[model samples]
Target: MSDNYTKIVQQNLHKLYTKLPPDLERNLPGHRNGQEFMFNAFGEKCTITPRAITLGDANYPAIHGILISLYALNATPEICLLSPFKSFREFPDSMPYVGAFTTHTEQLLEPHVPDIRKSAALITRYFNGEDVPVQGGGDFAFTLFPLPKIALCYIFYEADEDFPASVKCLFSNNANRFLPIDGLADVGEYTSKKIVDLICDVNSPS
Candidate 1:
């Protein structure tokens, strides 16, 4: 499966390079020097060229590589509009993936709310994000960019006398302009996974 995924990523990179856009920098909202582009992806530095997509200093899993490439391929010149964020289910034709998106992206973080609240500052700094005012009076909330052109806002509600802990993930209003719908779902899942990993690392014995 890993081998197959690698091949798929390579093919996607080929496609991205073949029809490379002249305004890629503007569209991706990333920096370009010669042929290489640099940007933040899921809280890590990402470098992309015609040959490969690398995160930080290593080659990441194929899923990440594929999503990064797709983000570039679908890059648009329009700036990201984050106001009035929308939920995954709110998007057109997003019903099929909504359940998985909820489970993997939102619910995945529910159990770690207390840890997240404690480390929210660290998480925001790592992801180059900032705290945002909660819209509906939740326990806490913050917004982070999982990709250069896409921002995700995570809202949390602590368990209380009558209800259990819950989380909600919302996308920047125009997130779809930078990736296809399914790709957007994957972005949320991967970003959520990154958050969990960061929390685990912080809690691990040193």
Candidate 2:
């Protein structure tokens, strides 16, 4: 990566990370006590774990950065980083792929998963009306480019207010609604076979 690219990624990551509140830094465990933070969860539960949050039980915060990091690891410059919210004035067509993802998330995917519909609606709104500029972060596009743009919403355990209680609720309620934090075995099983295959390859050794 160029010094400029690295610099930009570093700066933006810092900008975003600083926004994280105490919960992200919290050492608390889940009601299950067996559970861990969304990102920290491994094997099967990793994908299901809601994202980390900010305030009021908070919302998932680290998702975009990590996705961008994946994109940076795999994609090229022509493809932009897309989020639902865009500052397109500066980004132009080169905006990141996250926005395209938002559409997939709301229009096609969320409707199929009503259990999390309320949360999905809110996340959809967050990305709905914007043409924001892309702050080129990491070179994670390599991972993002191969797949169709898909929106990702991180809820964490924020659905509940009390700490471990909320987290337990989060896991219980959405146990079956796990997003592909890193692809689990059946992420896009039928919709796009080719893309799913590619993802599987990426997960496997080249």
Candidate 3:
């Protein structure tokens, strides 16, 4: 299933790339040297060329597929402010992916509770390298531009005496312009997992 998804993503990327205007490509937020598109993904520098997409020095197939798909489909390079943290149901066409994010968050993030400090630390480190500013929301809050036009705000609320730690992922009001609700969900899941893995890596013994 994952391999199929990657193939589909790649096909869509190619189709979209062919239709994209040259003026739009020039204005894209990343470092575009000729036909290549470049940007920071997590802490790694990603370059998207006509033949292949690479993350740092290695070929990252899945990430390349998703990111390039998003870039090709992106409507504009203009960014908007972070919207209020809300459930997926609050956004039109986003209700379908709510269950996936909910399940992932409950099973992975909620169980950690007060240990949200680790998640917070990982986010700080990730964004710090990208030069993206992270501001306080609950326990930790930051706005990330996974693509130049796509902005996602992640807020982690620390556990209190009565409740467990909870996470809220919100997107810019204009998110639907770039990708569909399902694609947004994939982005959310991918981002959450990346942070979780980073935290685990930090805790692991070398």
- As for TM-score, the candidate ahead, 1 or 2, is 1
Per-model RMSD to reference: 1.3, 18.7, 3.5
Among the numbered candidates, top TM-score falls to: 1
Question: How much RMSD separates candidate 2 from the native structure?
Answer: 18.7
Residue pairs of candidate 1 with colliding backbone atoms: none
**Whole-model alpha-carbon lDDT for candidate 2:** 0.27
How high is the CA lDDT of each candidate model? 0.89, 0.27, 0.62
Q: Please report how far candidate 1 places residue 105 from its true position, in Å.
A: 0.5
**For model 2, how many clashes?**
39
Provide the TM-score for each candidate, comma-separated.
0.96, 0.21, 0.79
Model 3 residue 83 CA deviation (Å) reads: 3.7
Among the numbered candidates, top lDDT falls to 1
Tens digit per residue, CA lDDT, model 3, 1-206: 27776677667657756775576554455677877777765456767665556676654537547655566656575654455434556778766778886776434565554444645655655644222233445666666565556666766677789877777766767666666777777666676666666777767899
Stretch of 10 with least lDDT, candidate 3: 127-136
User: Per-residue lDDT tens digits of candidate 1, residues 1-206?
Assistant: 28787787788889878878899987887899988999898888998988777898655656898898888888887889998999998888899999999999999999999999999998898888889999677899999988877999999999999999999999999898888899999999988988999899999999
